[model samples]
Target: MDVHVVSKTDNNTHATFSLPTPTSPLAGPSSLRIRPSLLSLTSNNLTYALLGNQLKWWDAYPVPSNAPTPYNDASAWGIVPAWGFGTVLESTIESIAPGTKLWGYWPASGHVVDLALKHEPDEPSTHWIEVSPHRQTLLALYNRYLISTSDDETRHAWEASVRPVWQCAYVLSAYVFTPDPASNPAIHPYPGIPSVKETWTSADADLSRAVVISLAASSKTARAVAHNFTLRPTSGGPLGLLQVTSAPGPIQSAATALKPHFATRAVDYTSLDTEEVAQWIAALKPAKILVIDFGSRDGGFEAAHKLVSQDEVLAKAEFVTVNIGYQQKVYTMSDVGAALASAAEHSKIQFNTSPVIEAILPVQGATKLFAGLEKAWDHWLENREAAAPDLQLVWGEGVVGEKGIEGAWTRLTRGEVKPEEALVFRI
Candidate 1:
């Protein structure tokens, strides 16, 4: 088994592990072999590393360590978790067969892994659980895998690369808009007047004219949310879609093509200030506002916090906030401390700092999260072709790919990868 490992002490570097060949698997359900094909390394994965120990991300998939190597650091040898496609090579379970492709979470380090399997009642997707005991306490979503459908292989690869982030985006859409905010039990907790039959309150004039502001607008997840909003306009849609992006070029390109249908106006991060954002909110007077920040760098948090905290902005329109991504890597103890302190300062703004909160809504659990994403998934399946061109697929193979993974990590740590390109490795 050949696998990759990031230095426990350094976020910018990684090490690859090549293990001894395993004996043929003719054993029980506990014995299985899988060849991982594609890995989607986006900002979302970076968040796993940033909060790995704190959140138990490292425990999701244990990486086998080879002795006398740079990766020998016990604490650092843990593999980061990733969502991708893998093909079954050997399985003792009668339900699974060699060459069968499955999509779900996997260890980031190696090309191959042997895991325990627990079958679920057969369904349209032939569901099953990867019962890796170390991951038992983690989110059930991470443990579940669906038998990959026999579809266009390229399309499967693309979907595998993007689905993890989409899961977060989709669930978010359902939380805020689905079942109409007025009737949703979750909406009752918020201060604003709840809408009875719409996403926002029909009784509150401001709620009817609500606007959804997507920070880090260039991200596929954020764009997907904006796109989903257009598809499921059960609440008469928002007054407008406002995209806050540091690099407006790619988003502008996308917006140009999606205009009039998924119409959005891109606001440059550098030039936009709290006062300006306040003006945008105030302009939509008598309407509530929701700002979902998918950004993690260059004052992304500070600027967003300030905008939503303004008296003028909140006077006529209440502000709601949710965070989804961390484009910036928090590497060291100092970095962690600084972020904690910074978060404390922004606490005054009352933003939902974690996706888990909004995603699970009204509570925190995996089953509810998955249930909420079904509609968004349906919409994406029908409209994937139109959205494919905006994605950049970079292929990495074998030893070169191993080296490429390290390079990609370094670039991502520095926020060098362009917002338009998503890194997908073909190992």
Candidate 2:
């Protein structure tokens, strides 16, 4: 058994490890052996590592000490988390047979994982939830696996590559754009969308009158959210969308891939000055601004300040910064002010920013969130005719050995990958 491991102590470092394969996994009805078919490598995977401890990503697949490796550093023992497709090689459960396809989270290192399954009747499905008593309560979202309902190989490939990112994008789009229930009773974001029960800073200005500015606009998750913006009519004056990217290439790519009507304008963040960005915001004539940052080079502070500090923009509009992912090493946010301070340090344009809020999907449970995501996914699949961009994915199967995984990681970290390409690894 061979697996690649990343060093938590030394940033941007990784190694490959090998282990002797057991003829059979521990015998029991609960045991199953899964061999990964494909793996997704993206900033989201990096986010998993960034918040591994807080989010319990490290525990997804813990490596044993017996695994052979050059260096036995304990800090590098953990496998970085990945979302992908794995085929069940061995299963003792009667309902789930061998060769069954499973789509969910997996470890980046080991090719196969021996998981103890517990049939979670909690949800009506043929699949079972991982009931390894250790991590059962850690994070249910990462623990459950869905039985691949489709027999078509092509569909499975698409689902395996795009599902995890789309799932996140779907949830973000639903909650952020869902029309206020008080204003539009008929228009609900998700079929059974729950309220944001967690403590999120209340929106100061009328969200219905806001324009959403998305940072890292070309990202798959950002595109998904932007796509939904086009589909749903906003209560806020015409639903205006603006995408901000670091380079001109991403701007052109996003504009070309997404329908021309999807964004009002695609701005290259690095080229524009604060006043220039402010002018663009002023042109929208929005009463308020909602900044949805997917992954920014220096977080969204620079972008946030441009809107919040500009006299022309701030006089008429109030702004809110909503962080979705941290592409770099995770920073702690003790309070709103502290978060803004961190952003200010890395920002090109500095100003007294408004509330920097972390956008948490205000849903009851992971099950509910997944359900809402599936509902929206179905809606998109059914309405592909209506100016929807098909899922764009890049499969790398020809690349052999652990080199593919390491190379993918290096490219992603350096931001060398194309904006529209969703990387999937078959190692």
lDDT of 1 by residue, 246-346 (tens): 66666656555544343357777764574765666566563666677776466766666566665554555665555456565645777667765764554
Task: Write model 2 residue lDDT over 229-296, tens digit each, in one string.
Answer: 55454453334666776544545454455453333666777643557666666776777676767766
Screening candidate 1 with a backbone cut-off below 3 angstroms (N, C-alpha, C), the clashing residue pairs are 3-109, 3-110, 4-109, 182-195, 195-201, 206-286, 206-287
* Clashes, model 1: 7
Q: What alpha-carbon RMSD in Å does predicted model 1 have with respect to the real structure?
A: 5.3
Top candidate by TM-score: 1
TM-score of 1: 0.82
